[model samples]
Target: MRIYLAAPLFNDIERSFNERLTSLLEPMAHVFLPQRDGKLMRDLVDGGMPLEAARQLVFEADINAIRRCNYIVAVLDGRTIDEGVAFEIGYGRALNKVCLGLKTDDRTLLPSGDNPMIIAGCKKIFANTIELVAWLRGGFLSARDAG
Candidate 1:
């Protein structure tokens, strides 16, 4: 299986969490982690690439990766959902790819919880990484056994 991991990669905390999650899932599937696979916008601009060009490159690369993935695992942990992650989830849903959510954050934008549209986009929302890993492994084992 191919997984497109969509998460906020703006800071050390977010990037580190994404790397850790990728490591766990790597043994099970081919994980397309943007921070590793795609060029960072900041890096490109810092290296003398124009801001617009960097943005376009990053956008295209992510979109193409999403198209080729079997599933999209979006990290929905924060005060509010990341705009890029939200867009990726919506895109993945439009492409009929399986969309899973990992939200460890207790804070919510709404009184009830996360936004309805974001929740609706996910096929299943995991409260923690352990649950997500277990669920994926179960599915992987089942598939392997069946095959």
Candidate 2:
């Protein structure tokens, strides 16, 4: 499966986490990330570029990557939902792609009722890295089965 990985990319810790997650997913399937350089937009801010331009670049790149992938695996562990991840989820759902959310944080932080990461129509939500791997490898049998 061509999987688009969406997550927070503003901080070093978050970027490293995403990288590790990408590595974990790569062996099972093709993983797509926004930046080939592995530098998040915030990292570019130190180089004197305007924050707005950096945001635009990241957003465009992420959207383009989402368009090229067959499914979306979103990281939903931050204090607030990453805008880039949210946009990717929206685009994936709009395109009728299979959407899977990975929440590394405690479930208690989430609301009691429904999963916020599931969006309106998404049904799959994995709790952690292990479950995500299992779901990706076993639950998703084929590309046609994803949707």
- The numbered model that scores best in lDDT is 1
Output the worst ten-in-a-row residue range by lDDT, candidate 2.
113-122
Candidate 1 local lDDT, residue 81: 97
- Candidate 2 residue pairs in backbone clash: none
What are the clashing pairs of model 1? none
For residues 52-147, write the lDDT of model 1, one tens digit per residue.
Answer: 999999999999999999889999998899999999999999999999999999888788989888999999999999999999999888988999
Q: What TM-score does model 1 achieve against the real structure?
A: 0.96
Show the lowest summed lDDT stretch of 10 residues, model 1. Answer: 106-115
TM-score per candidate: 0.96, 0.77
Total backbone clashes of candidate 1, pairs 3 or more residues apart or in separate chains: 0
* Per-model tally of clashing residue pairs: 0, 0
Compared with the true structure, model 2 gives a TM-score of: 0.77
